[model samples]
Target: MKRVFVTVGTTSFDELIERVTTPEATQALKARGYQHLVLQVGRGSILPDSDSCHELTLEVFRFKDSIAEDIKCADLVISHAGAGSCLETLGAGKPLLVVVNDQLMNNHQLELADQLYQDAHLLYCTPSTLIETLKMMDLSVLSPFLPGKPKNFADFLDKALGVQ
Candidate 1:
């Protein structure tokens, strides 16, 4: 079955969790041919009432040892804008939609998500814009995330430090 996996990583982003499970969002996902939605809700307080979401099967969990398997199994990934979660999903070569938590102080996530979006690696939006983004998103536009060579970082550091 085609699956869409939503993850909020280790923190709470209750808004994202709630938005994606709304009837409009579920209908949009269904229209796109997704059959199952599995959410890693983290510490979010709102667990969706699955019965209200028609024509889609929903699974919700708070935490897991690793979500690598889930990412691999997904046809698409909706994630919080945490660096780890974004890298993991992008590295898996899945179509990614990152939701930025505007409530946070400092809010570095927005910066990372913006750069990735500009790079065409993924799509991003605020929780309030999720449905519109979902309706408009086309996974075909994304470029596969090609990881840099292991030596690239070391080379950059060497150049910066002026080490021969």
Candidate 2:
């Protein structure tokens, strides 16, 4: 059985937590042999109040410094489109599904999420289609991540110094 870690960063994301803990979503996840569904709520307004939560090993927390430990243990990571979370998940080489929080001011997360999806670097889904997207995800198709910093620093320095 696999584990799933759903992290919403340090901001409230009640909508996301609610969606992931939904009966249908839980059922689908159980079908996929997920043994645990853990939520890093991060001040999120929603709590696991549904009876269906008992159907699985569901855990919720406000925040934790050891997110990488959870991410490392998880077979899959479902997260907000925040860059830190995206980079961490990708850097860990886990199959990630990012849902944009359009309500955030300026909504840059959507841009990052869409760009990563288009690049085949990660998976993206809206609040409405999260479960469906998860069911259809094929981790094999995800592009391997090589951080831009290490891979592009030389090119960046060359451009900055006007060297060939």
Candidate 3:
């Protein structure tokens, strides 16, 4: 049985949570043999009154001082497209499925998720395609996420301060 960790960063991403905890999604997840779902919802509003978590063992909370424990315990991760969440999940070598929040200004999360998917670093889906996307994947064979060398913090500092 696989454990899934869902994180939405430090802001409210109720919409993302709603999509995953929907009845359709629960059915699909159960069929896929997932046994547990742990959600780090931040300040999100949570699911609709009519929605339920189905038969799976469910653990959801508003926040955690550190998401490391939750991420480390999971077989799979479902995350918002924030860079921190995406990179952390990848660094941990966990299978990841990203859902970009289109409600953000300029659809910035969409850009991040799109680029990551293009690189084969992670799978991505929108709210409407969440269930369908999960249905199509073979998580057992997820590719390793290998990130490029990061720029030095000094480089960023210099660039930001216009100091060459």
Candidate 4:
């Protein structure tokens, strides 16, 4: 059985869980025989009220130091559509399913999600389409989207500053 690591935002696990209208998607995956490890890192405004499941294990307030290692060790990653999380997952060369936060009246996450989706880099899902998206994940089709360290903004700063 393959293992899937799901990491919600660092600052709103409770809000995330409350806003997540369809947690059955996660439950369905577990029912289908996948090992699901759900971790809530940092202090999130949202969180699940309970941590009971047949195949899902939920952890709250996990250490940041261990997040990278968890990402590296997981076969697939499920996370929110924060730039930091997206970039890190891409850097790890792992396929990711990103769920953007829509309740915040923000479009940045949605924009990022669209860009990554178009780039064939990460799978993006909105709350409405989450279940279908999860069902369609074919790990065999996953390829390394982002490789190695990303360019530092400072590297471009020189050109922007016109300093040769």
| Best by the lDDT measure | 1
* Poorly placed runs, candidate 4 (over 4 Å): 13-23, 49-51, 105-110, 141-143, 148-164
Q: Please provide, for model 4 over 1-164, each residue's C-alpha lDDT reduced to its tens digit, 9 standing for 90 to 100.
A: 45666677556544444433246666666755666555554566544544554446555454476578778877778787777788888888877888766675565766776787787788777656667776766656655674644467667887899978
Which candidate gets the maximum TM-score versus the true structure?
1
Give lDDT: candidate 3, residue 158. Answer: 83
**Off by more than 4 A, model 3:** 47-51, 105-110, 147-164
* Structural similarity to truth (TM-score) of each candidate: 0.89, 0.85, 0.81, 0.70
Reference-based lDDT, each prediction: 0.90, 0.83, 0.80, 0.66
Q: What is the per-residue lDDT of model 3 for residues 67-133, given as tens digits with 9 covering 90 to 100?
A: 9888888988999888888888988888899887767747665676678788777887777788898
- Candidate 2 has a TM-score of 0.85
160 in model 2: Cα distance from truth in Å? 8.0
After superposition, the stretches of candidate 1 with alpha carbons farther than 4 Å from their true spots are: 153-164
Score candidate 3 by TM-score against the native. Answer: 0.81
How would you order the candidates by lDDT, starting with the best?
A: 1, 2, 3, 4
What's model 1's lDDT at 3? 99
Error of 2 at 42 (Å): 0.7
Better of 1 and 2 by lDDT: 1
Per candidate, the number of residue pairs that clash is 0, 0, 0, 11
1-164: candidate 2 lDDT, tens digit per residue: 58999999978888888888887788888888887888899987787743458547987788887799999999989999898899899989898988877577577667777788899988887778887876777778889887667648888888999997
Ranking of models by TM-score: 1, 2, 3, 4
lDDT of 1 by residue, 1-164 (tens): 99999999998889998899988998899999999999999999988766667769988889999999999999999998898999999888899999888887487766777889999999978999999998988889898889869798899999999999
Between candidates 2 and 3, the one scoring higher on lDDT is 2
